[model samples]
Target: MKKLLLAMGLSTFSMAASAAMVDFNTADADGNGAVTMEEAAAALPEVSPDAVAAADSNGDGVLTVAEYEALASQ
Candidate 1:
């Protein structure tokens, strides 16, 4: 049915969107749970250190997965 096809299409789209999320491992080169400015720079050269600092929601001088995702989304 058309409805079933639409549901399958929507599910596929959702899966693709989730898959497009940033890969934390790529940014966390040292296998740390968080990313430092140096690691972020390696993965995202277009981003500035100041921007990474601003994205550090916890003021811990590093970025967790959530923080990194927020920066990537921007």
Candidate 2:
């Protein structure tokens, strides 16, 4: 039971750590909560242009929450 509890606690801790929030106010290179291709590039310049373009969901020329989540995953 102790080992099971420890494992559960560790799992929860790891999930919380990995689920850290991404701050758009700071991460928004274009001063927009939504990130444009250019802005996303500035946030993570190492990422390929194709990757940035792909991140622009809704086809609004900006990264939506889904896109930001995708970036966070990377």
Candidate 3:
């Protein structure tokens, strides 16, 4: 699954089943301190908005590296 996700370049993920961890810096794409919705979508195109929101514990509208890490763990 990890290889598949890598090969597909951030396709939809089954979070509960996922082990294809997201690399924060790689996903950030712009070197920004946080990952915005656009950045998250760009990194994981088919990932659900609800999922992202769920991961954004702070509700700050952007995912800090820690937030992103939490998202990946989901």
Q: Return the candidate ranking by TM-score, descending.
A: 3, 1, 2
Please give, for residues 43-74, the per-residue lDDT of candidate 3 as tens digits.
Answer: 76557888888888889999999888888766
Segments of candidate 3 deviating more than 4 angstroms? 1-20
Model 2, TM vs. native = 0.57
Which residue pairs come into collision in candidate 2? none
The pairs that clash in candidate 3 are: none
For candidate 2, write residues 1-74 as lDDT tens digits: 85465446545654666422433443464465787776565445456888777767667788876777787577
What is the Å distance of residue 4 in model 1 from its true position?
Answer: 46
Worst 10 residues of 3 by lDDT: 11-20
Per residue, candidate 1 scores C-alpha lDDT tens digits across 1-74 of: 85465446545654666422436765676787998988776566667888888989999988899999998788
Listed per model in order, the count of residue pairs whose N, CA or C atoms clash below 3 Å is: 0, 0, 0
TM-score of each: 0.67, 0.57, 0.68
Q: Is candidate 1 or candidate 2 better by TM-score?
A: 1
Residue 42 CA displacement from its true place in model 3, Å:
1.5
